[model samples]
Target: MLIDTHAHLNAPEFAEDRDEVISRARENGVSTVINIGFNRETIPTCLELAERYEFIYAVIGWHPQDAKDMTDADLEWIAELTRHPKVVGLGEMGLDYYWDTSPKDVQAEVFRKQIRLARELKLPIVIHNRDAHEDVIKILREEKAEEVGGVMHCFSGSWETAKLALEMNFYISFGGPLTFKNAKKPKEVAVQVPLDRLLVETDCPYLTPHPYRGKRNESGYVRLVAEEMANLRGLPYEEMIQITGDNAQRLFRLPARS
Candidate 1:
């Protein structure tokens, strides 16, 4: 079975037929999905979905873009949610220089706080980096994030960056971008990321794979990302599915089959 390690199924894009979307993913061999909570509005919904579905898991944290809105009390709230059995990790957090919705300093502060919280809770983190690779890597290292490593969700970085992340005990996750025709970098990184340190995701409701580009993405489309990765690695599609699924299970500490 394959795993979509990062998704946003709680978004309104899935409101009409959320059940059907998940069923389609199951039909296409995606057995597990890690739904992310990016802000205060979506955290509860994200956890609710995980509670409702045996194969769905939640990663709750604030996004850097919304860093200005999160408060210390909110961190406590996230900690409370972490006690739930289905809440698998923390984040979708990190730097986002591309948007600059929040000041860089504020984003960094929030990111570090979450990193410390994840360490305290003994949970993995799911990072979201955009146009701030250097700062992100710097902060992660300074914060000693390797103690409780996490996945760099929808990674769009150079092989050099990936090498550093792997050394830091983090996994490299490829998403819909891996399937884009012009996405040469992700393909190059896909070929080099070690099997044990590789993961696949859809980041659905965004970054739809080619042939379905510009449309609303769902977990079912993660197969296209996996197929692309398999081709790049010169491995069979099923083997890619198995290895990536295993990677996700190991990172999130889920059951072997889940």
Candidate 2:
């Protein structure tokens, strides 16, 4: 089986056919999914989906783009949701300098707060970073994110940055972009990162892989990521699925035997 470690299955794109999208993922051999919460508005829906779907799990926190309009109450509310039985992690949070929809300072401040929250709650984090590697790395280190180790979703960084994150015990997760012929960094990260410290995701409803590059994405496409990982490691497709699936279970503390 495969696990799609990062996905926005709760987004409006899946609103009309959400059930079918989820069904297809199961039919395609994806046993688990981590639904990401990118904003205050999506928190409830993220939790609700985890409750409604046997394979769905939730990660509640705000994305950098969504942080501009946030308030103290929003953070407090997310803290409250951290106690939910199905809330396995606390983020999709980090920096996104490419589009400073939120000021860099605000992003850093919120990122630090989320890191502290994750530690306080004893849940891991799911970070999202883009063109902000330096600040992201500094904040993560300063916040002592290693204490609550997590995955770097859609990780887009040089091998050096990846190595630093790995040294901190963070799993380097690849997404659809890895399958793109032009995506050298992710492909390079694929080759360098060890299988145990490596993970695969669809980041669904976005970054759809090659054949489905311009199409709407779903968790089912994670099989493509698994195939890509296997190709990178020269292993059989089945092994990639098993290893990454197990990695996901271990990272999220899921009751895999259950």
Candidate 3:
């Protein structure tokens, strides 16, 4: 069985046929899905999906793009929700320089707050780094995030960055980019990561893999990502799925599939 370490199955893109999408994922051997809920609008919906499906779990936090909108109450709200048994982690939170929707300083502060909160609750984090690797790493380091190490979701950074994150006890996760023909950096780094420290994802409703690029992504397509990862690591597809699935279970403290 496989686990989609990151996904947005709760996104509006799946509103029309979300059930079908989830069924397809299951049919494709995706046994578990870690869904991200990164902002006021999505947090509730994400939790709903987790509550609705036995195999779905939630990760709650504020997205850097919406950092300016987060308040003390929102943080408290997230803290309260983590008490839910299906809330597996705290994030999808980090710097996002590309969007620049939120000021870099605001994003950094919000990110720090979530990291601090995650540490307080003893929850592993799920990071979202986009065009802000240096600051993400710096803040993660300054905040001593290794205390509750996490996964670098949809990682698109260099090997050097991956190394630093790994040093901080972070698992390096790869998504659709790993399947791209010209994605040299991810391809290069995906092979070097120790199997135990590697994870796979779809980051669905976005980052759709090759052959399906330019189309809306779905959790089912994580199998394509796993296949590509298997090819990259020179392992059988089943073995790659087990390795990444096991890593996901370990990091999120998920129960073994019965």
Candidate 4:
């Protein structure tokens, strides 16, 4: 079975048919999914889905774009949510200068706070970075994130950056972008990332793989991403499934022993 380690099943886009989406993912061989919570308002919904679905897990934290709006109480509450049994990670959090939706300092502050929260809880983190490579690496290094390693979700950086993250004891995750014809960087990272440190995600309801590019995404399409990786690495489909599935289970500490 495969796993889409980063998805937003609770997003408003899924409000009308969340059950169908999850069912499709399961029917398509998705054994598990980590539903990431990014806003102050989404934590309850994220956890609710996790509670309802046996294969769903939760990762609670604020997104960098939403950083400017968070309150001290929100951060505190997020820390508290980490106490829940099914919540396994701390973020989809990191630097994003592509849009600069949040001020740099505010984003940095929120990122650091979430890092601290992850450290305190001793849980893995799922990072989202877009066009802010150097600062992201600097912060992860200075913050000493090795204490509790994590994955760089939808990782779009270079082999150098992927190497840096792996050195810091983090996994490299990729999604639909890897299937794009114009995604040179993701393609390079796919070929370079070690099989063990590599992971697959759908980022569903956001980054649908090619052929479904402009359409709304769902966890079931993660198979496309895995197939691309398998073809890129010249490995058999079954081996890719086992390796990537094992990588996800190990990274998220999924219930079953792989």
Candidate 5:
């Protein structure tokens, strides 16, 4: 079974046929999906989706792009939601220099806050990083994020950076980019990341995998990502499915399903 460890089915792109999308995911062998929260508006939707679907789970926190808008009250509210059984982690949080919707300083401030919160709650975090790897790693190190560990979602870095993250007890999650024809770095990292430290995601509603590029992505397409990981690591497709699915299950503390 495949587990899409990262996805955004809560986005408006799925509003028209969300149910059908999820059903297609099950048909395609996706046994579980973790919906990630990017901001205030999507947090509730993420929780709702988790509640509505037995196989769906949620990770809630502010995205780096929306860091400036996050508030103390928002942090408290997120803490409250962590009481929910389906709130598996705290994040989708980190730095994003690609789009400075919030000042870099503000982004770092909020990122550390969430990291600290995740530690206190003993939940994993889902980090979102874009053109800000140095600071992200530095902060994670200083904050001692390894205490709770986390995932580097849609990892787009070199093996060296991945090694650093691994040393910090973080799993490296590959998304649709790993399947792109010209994505050399992600492919290289895919080959080097240990099987147990590897994970697969679609980051759906965006970064759709090959053959489906330019089209809206859904959780079902995680199979394509897993197949690509298998090809990169010279393993059978089903083996890739099992390893990555197990990695996600262990990381998110998800129970084994029949």
Candidate 6:
């Protein structure tokens, strides 16, 4: 079985055929998917998808890009949702210097608040870092995020950064970019992450993989990422799938297959 460790199936890109895309994911061996809702708008929709499908789960938080829009009430809403049976984690949260839509200080404050909340709730966090590696790491460290270790979603940083996150007890997840022929850094880090600390995802409807690089992505495409990871690590494809699936389940505290 495979688990898409991170995805946004609630995104408008799949509105036309979300069910079929989910069906295709099952056919492609994706047994579970962790969908993210990173803003006021998506939180409810994210929960709806998870509640609709037994195998789909949810991760809720504020996106760094939308950091400026988040409010005390919104953070409280996320805290309340943590009680939902299918709500598995507390993020897609972190700093995003690339867009700079929110002031860096604001993004950092929001990121810190979410991390602190995750710690309070004892839930793992799913981080989204975009060109703000140093600050992200610094904040995670200052917040003592290791107390509630999480995944560094769609990680695209250097091996050194990967090592630092690993040191802080976080899993390193690789996505579509690892399959790109020219994505040297991600490919390098993908091969080096300890198998037990490794995870894979599609981050679909975005970051589509190799042959489908320019097309819309779906969870089924995560298999391509697993295949590339297997090739890079010199392991059998099925073995790679098993390893990542197991790691995902363990980190997310997912129930074991019967």
Could you tally the backbone clashes for each prediction?
Answer: 0, 0, 0, 0, 0, 0
Pairs clashing within candidate 6: none
Candidate 1 versus the native: TM-score? 0.98
- Model 1: lDDT equals 0.93
Residue pairs clashing in model 3 are none
Name the TM-score of candidate 2.
0.98
Cα shift from native, residue 256, model 2 (Å) = 1.3
TM-score of each: 0.98, 0.98, 0.99, 0.97, 0.99, 0.99
Among all windows of 10 consecutive residues in model 5, the one with the lowest summed lDDT is 31-40
Assess each prediction's global lDDT (C-alpha) against the native: 0.93, 0.90, 0.95, 0.91, 0.94, 0.95
lDDT of 1 by residue, 1-258 (tens): 889999999999999999999999999988899999988899999989998999999999999999999999999999999999998899989999999689999999999999999999999999999999999999999999999999999999999999989999999999898888899898898889999999999999999998899999999999999998889888999999999988999999997792
lDDT for each residue of candidate 2 in 119-235, tens digit (9 for 90 to 100): 898889998999989888899999999998999888889999998898877999998999999998788878989889879999989999988999998899999988988998999
The collision pairs in model 2 are none
Clashing pairs in 4: none
Residue 158 deviation, candidate 3, in Å? 0.7
Clashing pairs in 1: none
lDDT of 5 by residue, 62-149 (tens): 8999999999999999999999999899999999999958999999999999999999999999999999989999999999999999
Please give the range of 10 consecutive residues that has the lowest summed lDDT in model 2. 249-258
Model 3 ranges with Cα > 4 A deviation? none
lDDT for model 2: 0.90
